[model samples]
Target chain A: MTRPGFTGSALDRADPIRQDPAALAAARADAGARLLRMDGIDPVVGPDGLLDWGGLDEAPPGAFLALLGLIGGSPRFVALSGIPGGAQRSPLMMELLDAWPPEEAATYAAARSLIDWHARHPFCARCGAETAPIRGGWARSCPRCRTEHFPRVDPVVIMLAEHRGRVLVGRQASWKPGRYSALAGFVEPGESVEEAVARELHEEAGILATDIRYLASQPWPFPSQLMIACVARTANDALTIDRHELDHAMWVDRAGVEAALAKLPGAPFDPPPAYAIAHSLFRMWLDG
Target chain B: MTRPGFTGSALDRADPIRQDPAALAAARADAGARLLRMDGIDPVVGPDGLLDWGGLDEAPPGAFLALLGLIGGSPRFVALSGIPGGAQRSPLMMELLDAWPPEEAATYAAARSLIDWHARHPFCARCGAETAPIRGGWARSCPRCRTEHFPRVDPVVIMLAEHRGRVLVGRQASWKPGRYSALAGFVEPGESVEEAVARELHEEAGILATDIRYLASQPWPFPSQLMIACVARTANDALTIDRHELDHAMWVDRAGVEAALAKLPGAPFDPPPAYAIAHSLFRMWLDG
Candidate 1:
């Protein structure tokens, strides 16, 4: 059983300590407090090709801080809201996961999501007032309206939509040639996981999804998304591509799927990379 | 098998209509367009004791409109952001679920969640710009910053933690007397569902949970929330209640759970209502 990426984090995420301002301040002042340096939502790699770390002293004056729980016995932190979206962040995040250890990669993912949210949400959505970061950068509060804001992890359903024997896969024009992945869309405001699955299937492709089953989930922290992996049976396998969403979509049989999964050349289409939950979804589909 | 409340709706959620302004305008101008009336976040019951609905003519001038998808090919809309949060919304929402049929109830839940989110988000969190509702109230756009906003459905983990032969249950101070349910907490930005369950169980009641499993999900619309249901095995049964969060917590045995679930007199605790995911969680636990 291969574990999905960004799942098993070692941090305790000290929620009680977040509630106590004094305790948080004490943790920041502790001798073992460490900082994860970043470059515009991307983790900065040290000379050793690992996540760059320094003392709390490295955190700039008045810089917004994100407490990444406690790593071992040391309080790990990330300073944010300084370098906001100046680089290509999505690709960099995926690249980071490959370079670091599993727990360290998850820690970095947490830091990136927290920092990105804090950077983007300097003002309140309710009152348009400049909000202050609270709960160790886990939440924000507006001075004018006193409305508290927490970082949002948008839920998305990535489906391996099966019809008869073939499974549906889609390709975006921007992706590398011949590369395709599972159909996915964000879970809407007022929908259950199953409802979102059905809706997205209808919206993205001209198919109706039923018998939706939740397989697994992964934390995708490219600006914070929770990818809920599922398998759904589709009645109409006929591909009516919603061009606004996907460049192309088709029903691929088991041979093509197996070839793509094995990374063989001339396999009709390339599978999603290993770090992606779509890759895991494919594995789950094949295994089941 | 009993289905979770708010899990199914009859609406199409007309994403394509939302993208086409002309089509949406045509729908609004259509003689068949229906408006679901609301009274300060609560649905106004008609003379017949059903959801009060009127024509597009009844939508107040300058009222923010939420397109509650297309109900049986006629666009069902809700006028909102006018009467926002003056009543006891949570209880009213629960009451609405009991009164309406499953599909109608689900539609009401969608309207409530969408309208409430639209009401709260008058401005942008990214740039504090006063945003305009677009996509028929499905999304908002900030003209000043060119940023788009979508209604948020906060994810929460509701867990039934098993230890030995008993399950842990907790109660908040504001809840009705003698009522208890599974421990739940918000899934923070950087956490997975399993991680959230473990963190919440540890934070709310000093317990270590293992074998965490995802069972089901439900849309809980008081404001807006997606409750992810789970059951976990805990090594420790000794309860340590977080006084700041819960009034009390205890490990209740199968006999106690069965009695409470049966609503027997003097059962020691009242179970959560069927509308709540916690109620379903306990039922699943018992069946398993």
Candidate 2:
């Protein structure tokens, strides 16, 4: 089973072709080359419910074209802040993902993440010098120190903790009123994914997770995160919630999980949808 | 089997305890708190080949302590550019790791990574304002925009690609005359670890890998990298070396891999030592 939001993309990231400045310029001059403009982190969506793609002639002056990839034989590029008019910008949310096909959704997610990275990393971390984009926007190089910096995709562990017949879940204070998800946290500097799973479970919900198993991974690029999903077995049912990290946490049996997974109309507490790894975990646990 | 290097550490990263400045101060003044000072990226290693841990009184004036964790019943902190005279500062290398136990080596790795992160991220990426350390050095917060940034651990896929009784290996131009290792590359913005394995294999060595299996993971904190090791089977054995990325690419039989792994007194080309995931991958492949 595949997690839905951003899995499919047909773009061929022709690394060698993009390296040639002349070739890249030729692609930009081609009428078939599409330009996707971003306003901040959101892509400008036209009234047709899709990203407004236009030719280079229509692009604003001084627009820096960040090559996305080749869609079929034509090149696709994304830019930050150069939408002409008549289009509304929107953040990539669940509803938008649901309305689009997987391939288009994945491409949009990739573009948004790259655009966000470029916006933030304008200066070199090592030398405090202004950096310039290189390798057709795949990397940035500090001219002073010559340090090449690539886009950052932070790894996060999201685990479904099971003890006997129950699954452990927790709700964050910032989450919706009755929504709970599998315990999740970023993998720290010097730790494995399994270790992160155990540490996060214990810290957030006081559950001692063991027998950790890697289930799957998804590109959860809500500003670039790689969600590594796992199934962990916990021995203790008791949870001493760290109130600072979680609002509430508890053990829910298979039936309770199934009820939430059903997504019944007006259900108070809802499990994550098909677009999230949490929903995939619940379905896997229930099937087992 | 546990992978060697940066896997064993008994320190309880008491994150909750770190949130309270008053409690952290109390821990600092408790006399049981031990401080390990780092000069730039290297930790202060004593003549006895161990981190010289001492009380807060031993720390230099105006030294800022980054909390490592509670080792046993005491808090452990690491400072940068704080140690005064006598001790030699060194990077956490394989020779040093060979001298120290796994626990100590891992702790040093963690401390060094955190220290390096703090050194580089003095400015905010979001607002272009100076950032201040928070969460006891686990994170930094921008004063202007209040955006929190955590230490980055980039995920890299290092794989032993096998085709019909031989393993594929390559060496870069910058490497020593005859040092080769498994094909490896960093995981990019939008791909799974498995997909990364396939992509990197094709890109570097012109091998189409299939049936990818997760072997193990190790923390290679030469400024923070998580090496995810895997074993992939390739049906086609043809090699088209990307000269720009690799100096040499070739297939080695089981006997050749065994000879390299043995590190015979004056071997021409040797596999990495036990401290690296590349060595572990070689061992696993050799054993099979």
Candidate 3:
């Protein structure tokens, strides 16, 4: 029998093209688009037609992105592509960034995360002086102290909980209204993903997770977060929400989620669409 | 009952203080260390005792290297601390690189891996241009392209196979005389760890694995690799070693491994010492 969880199909998926770097580069360069400078415009296409932030006049293009192999969604890459600009101006310019297709979004997400990291980190932490990038921007060396720094991607654990066939969802104050999603938190330095999962569940929903199973992972590039999704079985049903972290939380059964997805008349809440892991989990529960 | 496999303790634990930016900065400042000039050294430290065939300089002074976090056997972080004069030297300067604790060779292994990654990635891969270190040297960015690059750690699958009570292991061509370890290989893009485990076993020893279960993970930083360790139950036990990948292969019953661990004079070969995961796997076989 299949485990009652979503097995992550997004991380490792076979693709013929991504295997050949030269072919991939040729295809990308031929896409009839000016390689946008990451530091110049906020790579994301927002509500506006054009990104307002200053963009670079010219950039030396190279293969700075890690072409992460395709998952079910699409082939992805970590964008190391940058334009001669800083973070402060680019955020505003991102207002002009336009919506991207699925593949482009995935690629953009990876690129944005890498570029954003570069915009922020220009000095060595060890010596508090300027450093130089090395290893194709995978590393940096401190000029003053001779220390090196590498890019950092914080690991965040996200999970869906199934209790008596009802799924648990939490909404943060910063999220869209009635837009409850999976519970998540950063993995600490010494903590395992399992430990992080348990801690996040306990802190956000006051629910203790017992049987935790791996689901899937997504590269969330808003600032380079690896979202690890899991299916967690709840031990205690009693709700004890942490108001400081989550504004509200509840256990919505599969039928209720289906209704929300339908946008049924008079529905008080709605789950995100199929694209999100939360919605995927909800759909899985309904299918079961 | 636990399966016959590796023993992983949250052992070799270092305090979280090492990753603290403030503490690390303070330590470096107190040492009177100055940041090395980025343009001063060649990107690659060649075989000679110099970078780009340059003369050696004294190591950086007052620069203290803090232990970065350990992944499995790899320890990773921003920079290594050393005397200022030692900064420009080549192979001798390698000593200034972070070394793992004597008791924690695995941790040293992680450090080795990360250091190796830094060595390979010094330029912006995207534009093939120079990049700068950022985020306290944990990351790098291309100035022209504005792409950020972070150290990459690849994943590998290492597994021990069991059929009834017999455990399977393989010896690589370069392995020391009489030394044998579990079969392993890089996790190919689009392949799950489980799939990789099965493929590697089949390729190395022609064994088909069933019921593959993840046991533990170690950061093998030999060049930034994460060794996803697992235990698999073999579907059948007929021997067919792939000559190219394996110098030798066999199925050893529990008593044989136990005897090897006990250092019995007659044992053909012993696994890695007690400090290694291989030894732990061997021990688990005995216990089972």
- Top candidate by TM-score: 1
- Model 3 residue A176 lDDT? 71
Residues B234-254, model 2: lDDT tens digits: 979989898888999888888
Better of 1 and 2 by TM-score: 1
**Which has the higher DockQ value, candidate number 1 or candidate number 2?**
1
lDDT (Cα, 0-100) at B141 in candidate 1: 97
* lDDT tens digits by residue: candidate 3, B1-288: 232111122223333334356754553444333222222221233354222212112224543233443335343333333223212335432342222222233323333433444444556644556666554444566788687766555556678899988888778788778887777776543234565677677766777889887654444433454555678998999888877668888888777887777778877566764434566556655665
In model 1, what is the error at residue A31, expressed in angstroms? 0.6
Q: What local lDDT does model 2 show for residue A74?
A: 86
- Lowest-lDDT window of 10 residues in candidate 3 chain A? A1-10
Taking the tens digit of each residue's C-alpha lDDT, what string does model 3 give over A135-177? 4344566776677665555556688887888778788888777
| Model 3 docking grade | incorrect
In candidate 1, position A190 carries an lDDT of 67
Q: In candidate 3 chain B, where is summed lDDT lowest over 10 consecutive residues?
A: B49-58
TM-score of chain B of each: 0.94, 0.91, 0.68
How well does each candidate superpose onto the true structure, as a TM-score? Answer: 0.96, 0.90, 0.52
Worst 10 residues of 2 chain A by lDDT: A82-91
DockQ of each: 0.77, 0.53, 0.06
